[model samples]
Target: MRVEYDDVETEDDLRVTYQGDLFTGEVVERSPQGQVIAITTYFNGMEDGLSTEFYPSGERKAEGSARYGTAVGVHQEWHRNGNLAARLEFDDQGKLLSRHRWAEDGTPIESFVAES
Candidate 1:
């Protein structure tokens, strides 16, 4: 993957710019203990597909789909103990369409629709 960035020199001559790849692939980040913390997909420097996060113990913490850098479609999150914590839906414009939350014991606690 080729990463492209623009350089802007600061007053002290320090350079900085936005960074990312211009291709599609999985980007893995590991914790200090060498455990996978997150796995994300990218397309044209934007998050365009499935992405996931993991708990320290390797359990899935969240899973979701994105398009053009915005969260879209069904996304799920879970508690550290593995119980579902929430489910959310978003429109193509990245606006949340609805959301539902659950308790640690797997009981539904709240649900609501997003105002357009």
Candidate 2:
């Protein structure tokens, strides 16, 4: 179910709730001006799917996946100008596996992999 962020309350480690019950589905957060700022997916009260955040101008700023509140797979962040800023990968258990970063001008900044 789609819910406005302001209409929901956060409880116990940031679990989303609506009308005092754990929420499952999508929560949409909007800027004061009524622009969508973020969209998050939840399951059984925990983050469990793709979540995305946007810049004030409606450009995608970041996106990632999660399972039961633990980050998984690849997460990406972008500069407000829309250039890729960072990319991070995580193991199934949410351990950081690797990370790559770049400057807003598209210059490579850092790249790392876990010692495994």
Candidate 3:
């Protein structure tokens, strides 16, 4: 699979296509003023992966992956100023697998698994 982005931002999605076949990706979200708000992705035309990023103010807000049209994998949450608030990981079945507090920056603090 291959992916590309002309000017992928908080308002637009990062599309992924395989061999000219539309595989998956997120959708573009725009502000009422016509700028951008967040981009939520879909799977085969379903609410699967979603990445709710913030505007130009510097806030991560929310960004992550999903499976079978559900939230899964690594999920990032942040403050309004583009700061990382939390870093959480989930299982394939939408189960909370791990979590970690955000660091001073928006980067993932650390990886810690949850008890099964």
| Candidate achieving the largest lDDT | 2
Best by TM-score: 2
Q: How many residue pairs clash in each candidate?
A: 0, 0, 5
Residue-by-residue lDDT tens digits, candidate 1, 12-62: 222222332244556676777878878777665567789899987899999
lDDT of each residue in 20-104, candidate 3, tens digit only: 4445565555556655567756565345655666665434567887765567888877776556778788888888888887665
TM-score, predicted candidate 1 vs. hidden true structure: 0.76
Candidate ordering by TM-score (highest first): 2, 1, 3
Report lDDT per candidate.
0.74, 0.94, 0.62
lDDT tens digits, residue span 4-106, model 2: 8888888868887888888898999998888999999998788999999998799999999999999999999999988999999999999999999999999
- Model 3 TM-score, 2 decimals: 0.57
List the candidate 3 regions with Cα displacement exceeding 4 Å: 1-25, 56-59, 101-113
**Model 2: residues with Cα > 4 Å off, grouped in runs:** none
User: 66 in model 2: Cα distance from truth in Å?
Assistant: 0.6
Worst 10 contiguous positions by lDDT, candidate 3: 1-10
- Ranking of models by lDDT: 2, 1, 3
Candidate 2 has its poorest 10 consecutive residues by lDDT at: 12-21
